[model samples]
Target: MKTGRRLTSYALNYKKIILVALFLLTISVGTDLAGPFIAKNIIDQHILGIESVWNETTNGKSTAEYQGEFYKKEKNFSDNEEKGKEIRILQVGTKFVFMDEKLEFDGKRTFEQGILTVQKGDEKVNYNAKVLTNKELMAFYKLEIPGIIKLLIVYFGLLVISAIFQYGQKFLLQKSANRIIQKMREDVFGQIQRLPIQYFDNLPAGKVVARITNDTEAIRELYVTVLAQFFTSAIYITGIYAALFILDVKLAAICLLLLPILYGWIILYRKFASKYNRVIRSRNSDINATINESICGMSIIQAFRREKETETEFEKLNTEHFTYQNKLLSLNALTSHNLVGVLRNLVFVAFIWYFGGLSLNPASVISLGVLYAFVDYINRLFNPVQGIVNQLANLESALVAGERVFSLMDEQGEKVSTKRIERFCGNVTFDHVSFGYKEGEYVLNDINFEAKQGQTVALVGHTGSGKSSIMNLLFRFYDCQKGKIFIDGMDIINIPRQTVRNHMGIVLQDPYLFTGTIVSNVSLGDPSISREMVEKALKDVGVDRVFKNLENGYDEPVIEKGSTLSSGQRQLISFARALAFNPAILILDEATSSIDTETEAVIQEAMDVLKKGRTTFIIAHRLSTIRNADQILVLDRGKIVERGSHEELMLLKGKYYQMYELQKGNASLAG
Candidate 1:
């Protein structure tokens, strides 16, 4: 019900179109039932009725009386039922004489144009009376031909009108459904922006993509197929019931008993169907996640020669997804359209037996026309019921999609304060900070650090020593569990995330590049950075030497992830990107880790220019990279164990000094 309500809220935005469709749908359904009713009328009143045989020789009206009412009156009887309802002859000198033998119509009636004839004067009309006996007599009572033509005209006209409205209703519904899908997609994409980083850390990339794209598309089917058909079917069922009740109350009452049985069957089907559908959806998400991972890691898989292993893992996920889909298919086969078909056949069987018993009893008041109409109405009712049953799978899929979409929307993200700070001094302070990425597991214990404006602070340690963790806290990616971080002597926790990150620029060990021109990647599409400025920044960072031979220079197109570029080229471009931003607080996380020794040797000039007036924090494994740092903090097991200049740290011969000696000896051995 909650899923249904959420979908309804999206639908209500386009209610005007929906309401128009509904009105047209009602008209179309009402017109459809008219065909069966018209057939009943032609069978009961026109061809099969006690039609008169008129004698043209007689002048004026012969007073023919039945039930004490004169039906042979010469006046027009089309408007007045009482004056001449028993019989009607519209021509002058017309007389229709009632015969003694009254034969009821036992079969169907077929009408033809320009074939009806009436005997005039004493003309002897020799007709073949032995074979097809009623053919000649049917022509004799053909004086009511004009009235039958009028009824046919009305019936066909209604059919044309019904066709028009049916087309309009379908077209409008499709348009409304498309608009609704667009809105739903927009809302899902917007919700993705508000989710936390940790939320993404737990789920796979492909799973998130499936929810944003594939799942929402499933909901689109809910609007197009399930919604339109379900609404039309409901209206059809109601119209069918009303027609049946008007025909005969007792028969309609018996038909109503089938509702509870149908409802119970639906309940049973949904119980199993929903469960299998959920499993199918979950497996499909897993399949998407696996495929995305495989594609992204294809280069690694091939380089390491793990193609067979990767293929085997992908096959396992695919097989699991396929197995669940088969289970859902099996569930559908047992209890969907087939079940509705069974119920329809049973209803027809019951209808026949009940009506047959009435036909045998002499005291029963029934007509063939009424029985024919009832059969038509019952069939009409079950047709839509079958359609609705067939759409059950779509409803289940849409509901599951809704649940996933809403779950992402409900996740808690960083509380972004509205207060803005356009600029900040480069000063940063960590006051007795203690932090952890998980509950009750402190990765950074009682950490204290400080970097004055325009000073370079270098963090060096072995792996898992929390050097990167300190940068994470400084950038406000994750808040510390205890104590506070201050910028320019003011706590930054109350500042908005966008505002705080605006003055910071980060260049990481592995720089990510989007599909675009090199200049756009360098400037990151910032309008303030002109083309000339992007060029200058690239030159300043020594990236021009790497791509000088490329055709378009900085304007060259970069393919996905910049896969065509060398590792050094990618890292150099990242440096230019950070330099172009000119952030007050600069962080380099092994930023030069990928560059060759010769290229790194030249980029030092660009690095000095970038860190000139900004508070810079360098996280590096190479002790040679931090030789000129104003302050060096050596971390061990989440605590800053030593703090001094590079020369001062070498004198202490502590953990930092030991790491320096090992790397220096390793380089000497390789040379």
Candidate 2:
């Protein structure tokens, strides 16, 4: 699916809240857009209504007394009521003049010496006029005060309603946005768990962390800011255009030109912005990767005095990121506000030209109210236009971030099965097994081995001699490309990876610890393992003596990678963790290589007590460590060249014998 649709699908998960928000938004926009129309009504019907012809009336209400005659405005005269001869009240420039008789035509008006001259193009008419003092003019305006105040009250009420609804919509929209991002982050993190180990081998931890943190944050802005602004602008623009058409259709149609222009600019802006944004986001990820690598290997870098070189490398990535950001900034500067300003200017020019032409004709002249409302709407129209233009950058960024997030989600991952199986009898076999991490380059060739129930087997080899690879295959970390491996007579490939490894455990050379107490790390938060079980496992691994000096004992805190602990302490915790699971098959991959002699002896004693009734596979380089094993396999170049008990291999004087002798000589020389 496309990135947009996928993002929309996440939004749909909380559509109810969003729909409520949109409903509130519609009400808010409706109340807000009603302002100009109400002002137009007040202006035309009450404030400017004094210019209409007056009729003499006997009615007391809404009647103005002029020159001892009670007269009412034409609009105030009831239908079918008594009528009187009409007189006019007109404005001549800044002054109001009272005319007893209506003129033949009304246009440019000038009153002098009690006569009113009205001219339109080539025509002119004259009327007897009276100029009202400020006191008399006040009488005419006093009649409109109550009506104007009522309309003003209604206008203010609508504004309050608009504000309330506006607040409601914004709060609800932002809440739903936060919820959507929460669920998206959860899904992304959960997907990470389902991904295979090999997937992580190619990508840096910081890049993965960026996907979950930085990229998702950009997407959050998409829902909260970009989409919110777009929705509001869409509604606001639509409302404004509708009001414009109602005020004047021709002007509204002229405004329609802006739609295509704005759209075309967006298309053009995205063409360049998308390219720059992609590079920026990629370089951002690269920067994160570099920082992570530098932090992780800081010791080596500082020890070797490579800080200057590392700084240069990091600066290069930072510079590329900075360059693209500046490019995006330039594009935004050139387009967003400038495009809106230009469009605003163009619309205003058209508006002025159209209205100017209309003003030349007496019949085509619009009321002040209508003209005011039109200008108000034209100005309001540019607001949403500017809003949309400014948010284009965020829109593109969100789409780019969405693409990265979805691409990670799109990677093929194995479904983790929760199915459990009975423990294996610890008989493991590798039958004609051959495998390689990459195709066409075999790391293990025709490897055949059988480890029976309750037997201890040891694999001795140099680096890259397929020792760890065999254990990886056994744990189903990677399936062998050829031949079948079996555990207790069942093909391991036929079982789910989780189920296949249910009865297995491993202790690596460099043990990994999480940020928690040692007890939590050992139990791994499994409900099946109790505190007592954890303590017992720790005791069985001889961690009691090793960690006895610690304040918290088994509950002691272990930070990331157990960096605060000694290597021996970390390895012992790893051993306790494995024993807590009580796996039938255990593989210790050079578990004692990094520890001191005393710690090694403690682990060896722990192994002697823990290895009963279980098949143990030891990948060790120390020839003395596995001397008493039931079977020893000596490997070279991905093939087993010798196999037997240590003493039998020694009597044969073969490859295993040579390796043992070489190690003995090295030990003697060191002594």
The global Cα lDDT (0 to 1) of model 1 is 0.78
lDDT of 1 by residue, 1-671 (tens): 48889889889999999999999999999998898888788766655443433222222233333333433323333354333223222221232233322223212222223121233233222221121124433443454465578778889999999999999999999899999989888877776765656577789989999888888888889998999989999899888888988888887888888788877877887787788777777878888998899899988989999999988988887788788788878888887777878888888888889887775654574666787788888888888888888888888888888888777767776544455566678999999999988988999988887899999999998899998888888877778899999999978787766678888999899999989999989988889889888888888987766676998877889998889998888888888898788789999999877878977876777788778889999998888988999899999999999999999999999888899999999999999
Superposed Cα deviation of residue 172, candidate 2 (Å): 2.3
Q: How does each model score on TM-score?
A: 0.87, 0.98
lDDT for model 2: 0.91
Task: Count the clashes in each prediction.
Answer: 0, 0
Give the RMSD in angstroms, all C-alphas superposed, for model 2.
Answer: 1.4
- TM-score (C-alpha, index-matched) for candidate 1: 0.87
